[model samples]
Target: MLKTAFAPMALLAFVAALPAAARDVLVRDQAGFAAAAASLEPGDTIVLADGEWRDFAIKLVGEGTATSPITLTAQHPGKVILTGRSSLAVGGTHLVVSNLVFRNGFASGDEVIATRVGKRWSENLRLTGIMIDSFSNPDRRFEDHWVALYGRNIRVDHSHFEGKANAGAMLVVVREGKMPLDNRVTLDHNYFGHRPVLGSNGGETIRIGTSTESMSDSHSIVEDNVFERCDGEVEIVSVKSGGNVIRRNLFLASQGSVVLRHGNGNLVERNVFLGQGLPHTGGVRVINERQIVRDNYMEGLGGVDFTSAITVMNGVPNSPINRYLPVRGAVIERNTIIDAARITLGAGASDERSQAPQSTRFADNLIVNRDGKSPFRAEASLAGIAFVGNVASADPKVEGVVVERREVKLERAANGLLYPVGATAGAPRDLQPIAREATGVAWYPKPAGTRVAFGSGATVEVATGPALAAAVANARDGDVIQLRPAQYLLAEPLVVRRTLTLRGHSATLRFSAPTLFQLEDGASLQLRDLKLSGSAAPRQPGNAVIRASAKPMLVNYTVDIEDCAFAEMAGAPGFDVIATVPATLAETIRIVDTRIADVSGAVLAGHSEKGKEGFYNAERVVFDGLDMARVATIADLFRGGTDESTYGPQFTMTDSSIADSGAVLLSGVQETTITGNRFVRSGGIRVTHSVGSPHTEIAHNSFTATPAPVIEELHYTGPARALLADNRVSQ
Candidate 1:
């Protein structure tokens, strides 16, 4: 949850000592915000109002003392939403921004949020509880990033980020042309979800330094974060620069590995990778020299080639940023790998230009192959690589080495010694468990509700009948309405204009008309544990289950449907779930743990029939743990637009199953990520006119009796680059 209250009185006393003019200012509009920012000083606080602000650029450019930094915060945490082509730049020293949400926006600049405005860099800056969702504009032909860090001693923590669809990383720590300065940044306790492939290279969750600055030493730290389905082509966390530390992070169902792509002297330790039987779930890949990989646990990794559990790559003598450099003095020690396909040494050794790893040591490591498969494979000769006291067994009789099914328990020691036998081998005590049960937004706890804001409107229970309309009409913000088990037939479209939740207990809602639900501007709706059924007759040309308009200048509308069932109805030419009209602003749509069976049209559609310049583009749309079966066409599952004038959509589908479906098509969009999904006799994915030619990622999926060509590229004249790795297809 976001922290809305100020700090203790003791801290406020220090701020009170500042100049009288340097006081707290409450700003409600853009003009007031501009005036406040221009006159900000030390110990000043700018509190934004709890509403939506559109197309505002916040360039915080003032220096503050170490003891009294300037702060920009929301009046009510998570309530101040900024949308519609917004940008933020934080420069100068000792500055902070917290609890502000930026969504449904595109960047006219190079980045959506940046530390350096132009030539100035930030120092001692901290960003907390800020959320950046789906900040990309597909109409811009060039590349754009979400967050760019070009400062020293920066800390970004306790934040949430979803749907970075354009090119570049979610967060980038840049090194300015080998200036002998360590960035010393730290990113922790954040949640990064579903970053799609950026067609070409350089699509990472967190990247330090670029090819030109690859030799620079960043010395950054990335820890305690959850990266779920971050299949951004290659290098989930790319440590291009040297002396970076990546530890205690949870990588769940990601296709790429943490790669030391450039530079040397990096440390990757105590990271936990839970593949959960997904293909191409890699652990670590070592590229440059003098890197240490220790005390990590990797389980259920099924990737071959360079994406193996632990891969040591052959380096080019004078390699560029894109190519690998030789590995020297890499120590792989005290780690446990369970059910991984291969632990490769000297990957790409056949390329004579790439030299083999020198002085690399693999010691005190335990590899448990439960299926009696070989865990170690050497692509080239291990000439200078040292292999000392490594154990490979189907059943290792060591304490704390419990193996059940495909998972292994190596947290405790049985005989007071770690497996694989070395002097420095022991269990690590610093590793923390990451929450896997809560996938996306559930990772963040919801605020406790007040007593008066309970049940429908006033803790009232409405039985199954025409009373739902009355209950909805009487509902207030944050009201919960409970429905009993019965069928509700709505004669007209039910329009919701408040923040409310409709929960069902074995209840079914059937629409007699074409449209079922319509969300007005500034409305937020959540439907949980209900069954939504469409009309029995075929859907007309413009009918939809749910319809919402885009009002960018208004509030950021949200619709969350979870643990529900969408029963199969008659065939329809329109969408089955939701559709937005053209020229609408950005909105959020999330469908979790739902089942949709026997649907005729696209599951979700976003388009403008009139071809308006500013069409309705989704800020972020996520589909998790969905079981979709017998759909007519999966093509344009969640479309952005029909042509080039429309901006792309940011879409992510994880842990879902699609069986007997048609082709999935993405055109004129930014990104479409498909990870850890099962396809049974379904059509493949087609990409055309996407901003990044292959910004779509189809990774770690299982295909049984699917089409011959799993991924098709159409009309993309550039280098067709999509990351298709670790897919298990049984033709």
Candidate 2:
């Protein structure tokens, strides 16, 4: 540490004003670095020796001139590794840090890297060419920020941050103190990759500021970043401060929107959302005031609610900073939106958020939607909104958007994007195409592994041993392994790594091992007409018969179970009949016309920890046309213990019969429906914590005697909506 003998301000000026002769100091280890750190002067460059430097708490603190800044870099770029609980703290003026990689670990504390240490602040710092890849904590509940920026004039560019499986944002330009000051920060040319569904609020890739400082100005610029498969939450880039410019970012196949959640005077333009018709892929969502969204292009997105392309949300009256504030003076224009699911105006209009958006202008935009949904959807009143010069190609019959409905043909360009054939239909003036090769470090490639192209295969039948394993091993993407009509006893777990089906027609698969079927990343399972059971002593490891990938995956898992029977199954203390590993999720788990009986644990375990925001193992679960009985619980889908999460499990169970079991019903889901079912001698249904909307329905069901309909006994909050009627209760 540099000792200050003179007055603090005068000493800072005296040190910052002096420019030392430039020198290069080579240090092999932390001990060697510490010996030279205390005497660091302006224009000094400290070069760390490459190769595994594990668990090093590096602190660089000193003043440097703007013209001659101090730098800390690696002897060899892309070779210096900071693994196993390492952190960096830089507290001073005019410093440049570059070319260090963080891998296979997390921070020792709440932050992996902080620009300030305690009350000491940093100014005019630049960090570039850094990579934090798959750097995660084991405990998903433990939230840690990767980068926390403080003070003024900081820039983090040409970096790659990927696979943050745990909670917390990847980068946050922090604004502290009771009266926070303006901090000018820039985050550009970064690559954010493959963030899984965190199922809660702490999953933003970049958050400029928080709610307490939402009214303050950060003056941050986040542009030219590439976010690929970043399905962390509804808000990928959560802008929570004022006077920020978010432009020219490319979101490729991601499932979240850039939301202006708070603050005012933000400009969002020229961003391209190329989703390829993936579900839950969104464009931009607008809230609060003085936000302009223009010159953006979106195509092949399928999301609703807050993930809608341009969601002008409903607001709470006189809301606080953290809550949903009223939308005022929002301008959305000059954009080309094609093949998106919906563009919502006044979305999420509930009794809680009764105030609609005010003084909004939607003008001169071209929308082409071909996914059978209307291009524009207005859930709230459009009294204060002005719609002008907008053109729609599909379903232009929607109200409040009185634009021309015409044929706007599209052609697939060389860049794989759909462009208008030739038109002046109020689209953007120019297509600002961002190059795919212009973001992130040149050394670090995309975090997503090689995309495997599986060949078409014929259906193979097998009984057991390497024959069955070989059949599965030789299977391709759409292949089916037809099981023989006999007991296929599995000794070891069969891990499925491809998209295939297990055709078990009147066949029984007995799980002697911990897991009968394990799914790695990008795996999908279709099990039909099968009987799944366990041995005399059931195996452990989540007490699950099947498990998903242990780590966060780029493409989420999808499992479809139909006409399947489960009985005589027992597992570890906390087991699910169908379960996934922590921090990993199955996008859709649809169980239809199935029967489950004699399970010791819940029929399904939602492996989310308590007291965490937006943590879930599955995105959407459907239990339709099934018969479940004699289980601990039919479906225990509970993202329990918090009102902070906005992501929902989105549960739906209709036309089913659940007997002699308990049911949790719903918890922390965005939308739920428990309709058209027969409950016999069960604990009944309970609904808790309706996150964003209160659209829960428990309607049109029949309950046997001894368990009266108890919708409000477990939770009396306003989550349970109307239509809890039309139920037949037998006395």
Candidate 3:
């Protein structure tokens, strides 16, 4: 009886010694927050007051139990705004960060939210109800990430990350050391919105592992997310690690694919691609081994090749870890593909990537092609591939599988999707896609961007150099700065940031500046009826009349030079009439009714960006109705260097006249058509006709008294599939 009494007394003493119940501490500044956080116990809450918190480096490091987690939240959800070099560093176990907004700002360092600080890391942490909107660097070339996840058992849910107009993936799961990653992180119910075309390779939405961790297993899960118009690069969710599962996500009108890029043993299942016939919207691409793609529903995707509705890629023979690995045991089964552009097999075969997919099974899918387009286009051989139990609108007698095709009629499902009527479960009859409204926070508004029509804003007229410079600096978002018909000798270069038209009525703007006008990211410059010339003493600078950018940058709006004339550009050897620096990309460069004469350099030049994997600066280049003479090289527009991505470097130079110029180098581009153009004593067209760019045509062009070799074919591999016909050449 005495022993029982002593035990009860000891238990009572221990319970009395425990700290008081958890409390909520309100902090107004970073120092107060840090002080409150240091003394926090389990279940303690630190609430930040509602205000504009600028340049706050928050370090919420603590240790808490699973049942009573430490929380850092706002007084009101999304009322505590952080801007200008604000970052959140989270460490320790069971820590929760919720209900804050990081907007109109960029990270002071590389990451906005990093789970690991030095050697300390967070495990079993939850980051929920956060908004990172327009949190991008001023320089789009500089790379940064919103959330860089490390450690294990992390959950990022119900968040809104929008308007990432810079380099780097929005979120990345990284692992330290050389060991394989086993993070088990879950990314769910998030909205990745408004990621414009980054025009580079570092524009993925969520990248699980990287080329360094390609051979490792992450075991991560990305599900129930909505990717809204995230047209960054060719790969949206690049799965570079093994054993990760991506399921039930809605890729809504995005321009890239969910690529199994590097590692193997990944599963992509039940995702719905609601493309709605959007151009360049893609589904899934299969690479590596043991990847399973099953029970997915994709429709109205307009991308082809690597960005196809379903692309099974050809791999490199004996590839390294960073390069393309051969696709083995890729099981693609029971998917519904309707009204999509192309379901390609053996896609992206080149000089190095020549190994066909071995032991792959593509079975039990339903393909409905109503556009009368051939639903298939193959570059690699169909050996060792199996296509079985699939119902297609076209003929089912394709190479690979010997299984007979199924005869089924198409019927509209209740969810507005077309399904195989009277089909079983294996025919994808029960795949229920999620609604977009259920994912993100209802209060946080979705981003809306409208292409400001040219000359739609206030019309400001400027005559002098200072007036023109001031007008450009103070113009509205979509203003038209009409340069009065006079010679505006500008002393400094002008950088444009908004969508504007610089209309000059027979005006001449002569300058010695390296770049007369610089177009930054998200800026559009439309030069209408301007006579541009440069006659100052040459300073050996690679000057451009209207340079796009000198450094690497992200996507710019447009550069339309209509009815413009370039008299001369007297500068260094690398001078160009209108130039784009390396890795600086523009959406379109349409020079219509343009005339170039007495130019010492190329009309268009940006070919310095060259290396391994084919990434040029521009997406499309059009030189229509151009009259050119005395120019060095009439137009040397290098689009795709050696890219295997499906997005094209479309080039169309139709009805142009060139004389006494350099060679027109256009071999590395795709979607090319050079017809009805006249060349006189100048360099002929030099192009490579490979299997990768088979849809090329150089036809119906007259060459009078030209050189002996009018068309130089620099074939890389295989015979030329390009149509070089109906040319009249007189030597």
Candidate 4:
């Protein structure tokens, strides 16, 4: 959200007082657009109409004042879709382009949009409220980029980018020559989604400066953006130049991490990496000298080798642009890493030719390992690195390196500097709020909430396993099956088909195997005051404790779980406590007053099934007063898929607390309200790929001991409508 304070009436009066040559103009097609571009003046607006303009190219060469920029915008945001080999070459100074959509298009040249048209570089350019969706070539080879900027003081904000396929990066900042100053670019409040892995390298989502210009200073800022499934072989946002800042961004299920591949004196801070147990998913990969990586939270990272949570690679001194340089004076501090398999200190240690990173500092870092294995894996000796005040599950004996052996415990506090152990860590900042009139569109409708009334019916008391099984099988609607204070071992899943209540009075259900108590369509289950544990050890992939699948027929299903606990349940690495379902059916799941500990999977995971077209939709869901700790990953705490028709999930969570968890990926979802929740040392909440404007409300949430920007909304094209407000976030 980007807000600009401008009085329309005052602006009208000021414009009316100006000469007619300074007025705005409407351009409906390529001819009019060219005419406007040829005679573009300061304080002028060139309006592109709403239609499919195919194979059009625009070379905007204009000179606007610092106070007045030449504007090129659509008649309506997301309405003027540009298709088929369109290109925009911006040159000159003080230009503004907004509210244009470029989709179903292929590049006619190396880039669809370029700031440097020929040898001239644009200056003080701003692109806002723009959307580029599924803009790719026919071969899916990234031969061109969506945006190739070669300019100074450039700002790209509040834009939506989706489905970038092929061989090149989605966005690139090129440096043609050494300038007097760095290219000061700001990329904020943008959404980058679904860029698949290019078989080889060179497919970064955002590449700032190239290897040839790696040493040149590019003081760019990339913030408040969402990177979802942008797994373009490693290095999602490759920093090749020096003195850039990447902060307060959400990287959700993206295969790679932010890499300072060739730069020095760069800052990577307050970013959230929600890997969700995906292969090759990682955190920040460090190289070069005087770089700072701090206050980032990484969870469910499964990558090994250089793709670990934080990999400090050995550098070759005075190396070429493509080769790593000796990493000196690097500081890695105040980061929380949970359920990551590897946190390598010396990534290139095995290669003797690669020089060891020297004078690096690692401090105030917390690594919580649920598995029995050690979190720190060093390939080289730690003699040259400075390791201090780092907390892990156990002593990470790195030969000569000594780390403080203390249990990392994270709790919610009013004012905490760093995220406690087991809390979401990352950039906890929100985008600047944009005024509604700035976007020229209305927000999407907010979903209504549905509250179900539960009945207290007859009670069936059970003392033994057989009695409990029989009672569950014979239970009627609104009947309560109460279990006595005992441990019951079940060999199979208890399939509940009718409406009933399963209450526990100091009772525990230990499953012989990984099984789920499933609830079918038209069935409702209420579980209260029970403990569920699995006898199996935590292994590869685990199973869910509760499962619900929607049938093809549209029906309503409900599951209300309260005051319960889940422990020692070994789920598949990426599985969840609640399994995936379909979108055709209306379902309501409410988990309140519960404590989930030592769980190896997510609390609730939703996804569109493979070969399935629709999403796993829920009419309304709520999570209240939940204490979720020591969990492996909350992958998409409300997960959705890539299918466009799959509607977003409407859900809310209030008065809940989560620590040591993965991200709550609200991509492709709508109408989410997360209020009064306490997130300590956990992954951030990211909303992206949304269907409507102002689709979610996140208010009054206390984010203590966390990074900046607790909540982020990315790549939404609709009008801004008061979504995030009054959240207490500590940096």
Predicted candidate 3 versus true structure: per-residue lDDT over 1-731, tens digit per residue: 89987998999999999966998999999899979988879899999999999999898888889989999999998899999999999989999999999997899899999997777888999999989998988666678999999898999999999888778899999876642279899999999998877655678899998877678788999999999988878889999999999999999889999999988899999999988787779999999999999999898998887788889988998999888899999998988888888888888787878999999998888777775444677778888688777667666344553433456577778776777777652436666777767787777987664468787898888888889989888877779888878988877778888888999998888776777888776688888988887776267767777777655565556888999888766455656777777757777888999888777777777575564445566677899999988778765756443444436566788999988777666646667788999988777677653225446788988777665333334545655657778888886
lDDT (tens digit, per residue) of candidate 2 on 1-731: 33455568787799888766788999999999898788888899999998999999899987888888999999988899999989999989999999999997789888888998777778999999989987877665568899999788999988888888777898888888732358888888888888877766687888888898789778899988898988777888999989999998899999889999989999999888988787778998898998999988888888776787778999999898798999999999888888878788888777778899999898878888765456678888988788888777865565666676667888876655666766565435455556656878888787545233222456788886567777766677867888887887777777888887888778988766767788876588888789888653355545667777666554567888888888777454555688766666677889999888777777667754444455676779999998888777777676654453355687888999988888655666666788999988887777665355545777899888536555432343434454577888785
> Considering every candidate listed, which one attains the maximal TM-score?
3
- State the TM-score for model 2: 0.83
**lDDT-superior candidate, 2 or 3:** 3
State each model's CA lDDT, in order: 0.71, 0.79, 0.81, 0.71
Model 4 CA lDDT for position 572 = 47
3 versus 4: better TM-score goes to: 3
Tell me the tens digit of each residue's lDDT in model 4 across 1-731: 12244566677899888755676777788998888777777989888888988999878888898888888888877778889989888888999988888877677898988987777788999988777776777553237899988889999987777666566789988876744248899998787767755433456899998778788789999987878787665678989999999987878777877889887899998777778897678899998889999977777888766678998887665677777787899999878787887887777552432577788888777777667467687766676688777767667766755566655564433322224545332223232222222221222111122222354567899998778878877877678888987998777677776777888886998765445576664467788899877545234564777766434322346778998988776444644567655432335678899888766667776553322222343545788898888776553533333322112356788988878765566655555788888778877576664332224688888777654333443443334533678888884
Model 1 lDDT at residue 586 = 39
For candidate 2, what's the RMSD?
Answer: 6.6
Per candidate, the number of residue pairs that clash is 9, 2, 1, 31
Write out the backbone clash pairs for model 2: 199-614, 200-614
Q: What TM-score does model 1 achieve against the real structure?
A: 0.58
> Between candidates 2 and 4, which one is better according to lDDT?
2
Ranking by TM-score: 3, 2, 1, 4
Q: Tell me model 4's lDDT, rounded to 2 decimals.
A: 0.71
